[model samples]
Target: MSENPHDQPETLEHPEEALHRRAIRSFVMRAGRMTDAQKRGIDHGWPRFGLSLEQGLLDLDQVFGRQAPRTLEIGFGMGHSLLEMAQVAPDQDFIGVEVHRPGVGSLLNGVLNAGIDNLRVFDCDAIEVLNRCIPDGSLDRVLLFFPDPWHKKKHNKRRIVQLGFAEALRQKLKVGGVFHMATDWQPYAEHMLEVMSAAPGYRNLAEGGGFVPRPEERPVTKFERRGERLGHGVWDLKFARSE
Candidate 1:
């Protein structure tokens, strides 16, 4: 999708203006209701592994009692979809990375409440978790559903489907591994398609649109529900690692 032109960050012509813009942007970004302490606790609560900044590569055999195929879900908003996937695919290990505090708490609570054992959590940036923590070609699947579209033009650079990011993911995924992504924003979906198409070493799994629905495995999340209510279009893209 073409970026929104008006959403671009203002370019300051003077040094003082640049400083002022930086301060204003920082303050505005942190203006949400979440407290600094809460954010800090979430940021530091998770331990880092050598591969990904967000996750550690401890012995997975210890956690699941046997090494199992691993799938990653990035930005699990409230854990509903992650929980459902875990339930449906009990044999596959799922790792979820999220930075939202309440969402992390809710995911933990849900995992405990539902007695789920095949999942792990990391409450931080997924990029750090994937690049620094996850071993190359170790993951069987990756899921990114309903990520922030950063709809404004200036912020489009912050969107996650850049060439470098896709290349990193390609490295982490095993040959024939699956990468699934969904978005309710049409422009963002198109942008994702363009980005992924340009990335080497991967192939689209679905010819026309993408993979068919594994509805039994991937339940709709609350965010998707709200998007549906708002008459927004949802797009799903699936790709596989190509040798």
Candidate 2:
């Protein structure tokens, strides 16, 4: 019997673990409505482009059909920019992990429309995907752009940039591999800086040991553009794993 493609488990070996994950999630799966096109995209594109949590650890070379730089983007909301990176970097293979079904469907639609072949997606929690599937020290780059800020003071604990998260991320990245993150929320950015600075086995890539200017490859998202127009500042942090 085949595994249910729709079940986004935290651990493929223990689907029961998903219940506890929901309580600690950095994101609250938005009950967004999926458009007909998005639904159709999942129907037509998932078989070719979607990856399941149930699939367990993946062989990057085998998955992409060739040896190449592997990049993973956590919470690639809607995937417009994720697709852009994949389109521009043909030599790299990208695996995007996102939890929202609507976003997954929407991205799948884009994958179909663009005729892209160098990307695959996991519709599950980023932590789970990292813990159970992605091999240690296998990724060359990890992109984490605009993750939820969890604004309220009471919810700051929910932010994904905690010390433990940073440590785990450091372990997964190959030596000299880049861990890049960007956020429009200033407070959250500062939080990121503090945590990442304290995390061992990594070095900041920015000058003066502070936030860096957005790199050329990171296309400004629609929400980010809106924030810019409204006088909001965006922070980019790039840290390399150090052995």
Candidate 3:
């Protein structure tokens, strides 16, 4: 019997390849040179606190060596705010993901100097780390602070707060876990609000379904301070997983 075209099953594209095509990274890596201190930080601190995608799905309890509230911060620039948060909240375990080598180095150095054991780091694409390393529904909180706004109108599509990203974050979060995001760009904030508002399995933590006051727990960043001097208003949004 002759084979019919309809009888042949459609060849499916690899899911990871499909994801790679669909995901437009929001940040551009700048040619920022690392200082000697930063280099040393990477060398010395990596063994103690660094993580890799090749680790596969992590057991949060095993990684931290304790059962504590876990907070994952997507981009900890220079490491100061995240370090401060870790210092203040010793009861909580923090996992920071930063692709910028200099920033990662700085954070690692800070972590070593601070002697804080409640924190760890991943120097890779946050999305990949989330997808391949972090176990689903294992997080207590997820933070996205001052992510690349992709401010230009033509580049807004590259912003990371799209519906797909929100859903991915939701999967990593435990039920009732909160995804807190802060942005200095107003349009990007609105974009985040729109996507997160419509995203399933989330409930806006804002009382009336809009921006919320910046919580005290979130330390103000240097970028935020500079934006403040330029009269840029910061928007903070918190959405909790309902299921």
Which predicted model would earn the best TM-score?
3
Model 2 spans with C-alpha error above 4 angstroms = 1-23
Candidate 2: C-alpha RMSD to true structure equals 6.0
- Candidate 1: segments with Cα more than 4 A from true spot: 1-56, 209-216
- Shift of residue 240 alpha carbon in model 2, Å: 0.5
lDDT of each: 0.68, 0.83, 0.84
| 169: Cα error in model 3, Å | 1.1
lDDT for 45 (candidate 3): 95
lDDT of 1 by residue, 1-243 (tens): 223334434333332332222211211111235455444434543332112342365556675577899998988877788878887888889889876656665566666666767888876667666645677788899998888887876666667766656777787799999888888888898888887887778898876745445434568777778978989878888888896
Residue 104 of model 2: what lDDT? 89
Write candidate 3's Cα lDDT for 71-190 as tens digits. 999988888999999999999999999878999999988888888899999987787888789888899999999888877676666777776677777778999999999998888899
Q: TM-score for model 3? A: 0.90
Q: Which candidate do you rate higher for lDDT, 2 or 3?
A: 3
What are the models' TM-scores?
Answer: 0.76, 0.90, 0.90
Q: Which pairs, if any, clash in model 2?
A: none
